[model samples]
Target: MTALRALLLTVAVTASLSACNRRDREPAADAPLPAAEAPAEITPADAAAPMNFATTSPYAAVKLTLPNALKAQTDLHARLYADEVRLLRQFVEGAQADRSEAGDDPSIPPYEKTITLTAAAETGKLVSLRRDMSEYSGGAHPNTTARGVLWDKALKQVIGSGQLFRRGADMSLLDQALCAAVNTARARRVPGAPPLTLAGGGEWTCPRAAATPFVLAPGTVDGKAGGLTFLIDPYKVGPYAEGSYAVTVPLTTFRTLLAGAYADEFAGQPAN
Candidate 1:
């Protein structure tokens, strides 16, 4: 999702709620980083499992687009080609590194990925993409501070109704697809690949970071390679008067897909 999509969805979901914000629920005064907790590993066994929330059914009224708060993370998915392997490697390594860095410390929340796929009895294609936000965003907030309020508000909006379709692909298959996309990108891309349609598109939004921040440089590579690619003007004017970007990854891979670029501050996820 481009920053514009993130912003639109954030505005849409957050408009009724509130402008938000986090740390590991960062501890203050005399507090020490807690022990290292287990890593957040998304496994097939875990995804096949049942979920505690309600599933999507043909009876569903509206397609629940993720609220900005929760959708933010899901949106991290860069617009890589369908078969970029190195990109996928970075994604997995990122998961472990991010969680491990947080550690088992008392201040950090334990990391784990709980993927629930509920096929609506009516429209089997539309599946509810629910997770244990309790884990992903646990420590991301703290006692109802101003920041906490914003973060919590965002997650609440996205958790329930967000829909997903792995192209009829299950958890394992999706994982494989991710790896495949990353590999394909590596084989096709030369070192120092120039900014292409999907390069700078790896942008994100952080209302709290800056009024509007550019996450990366004018040239940044979206680490995936897919068969179908969408091209856009790298410097196209955006919602915040910034720019727009494109990607190769299928639209289904992400939710709340937007069409905008950024100021270059909200680049791809940080290096762990």
Candidate 2:
């Protein structure tokens, strides 16, 4: 009887030990699950691939190309994408409405909107980009527009034209310099056209350097900024027939106007 009791006690102890082992191996019902793996980071190589979107139907056609340089920065890329998508949606809606009202007019041309962003210069942490957008919805011709984007790599955001200069800096000097450059370019394009005056008169009035869109242009030396290139779309300083004008103002022309933070980023003469 004593041997039988000892045997029973041993069996109970063994079962208890096994139960404890099982409890240690299995997770508690209330315990949190393992975390999911994080998404891969975007590298320069991944950003090199441009983001392109295109679609066409009987109603309309849309095409957009965002350069890889713009994609390198996370926030900038998201902002640009959202803006482009919004514009694209508006165009699509307009096309749908036009088609509905026109009642299957086969002769009507399909509406179009093409937008492209190109890297103008990349020096240090500054990236200058030019955006050209063309849209046509049964007009005399497709209207084209140009804009400049100055992106700061370190900040991961866009730097406005006003931010590049000192607080309340007298831009009159820069304006005069840009006006002179525009006249030079105008002479080459339209030999007999009247020069643009800063006095703001008629169609030939010179655009203010502060109000115009401009990008940093490449310098003669590699990896350096030469100057600012003002992007003047058609009908700005001249008639639409003259097309667009890209007047470059060398660093020497507007060096003193630069903010203290941006003084070191510019050097050399314009490569063009």
Tens-place lDDT per residue, model 1, 111-228, is 2222222111111111122111111323333211010001112222211101112233233432333334433443354344332222234432211111111111111324311112
lDDT of candidate 2 over 139-187, digit per residue (tens): 4566676777777778665676666888888899889999999999999
Off by over 4 Å in 2: 1-50
| Predictions in order: lDDT | 0.23, 0.69
Worst 10-residue stretch by lDDT in candidate 2? 26-35
* TM-score computed on alpha carbons, candidate 1: 0.18
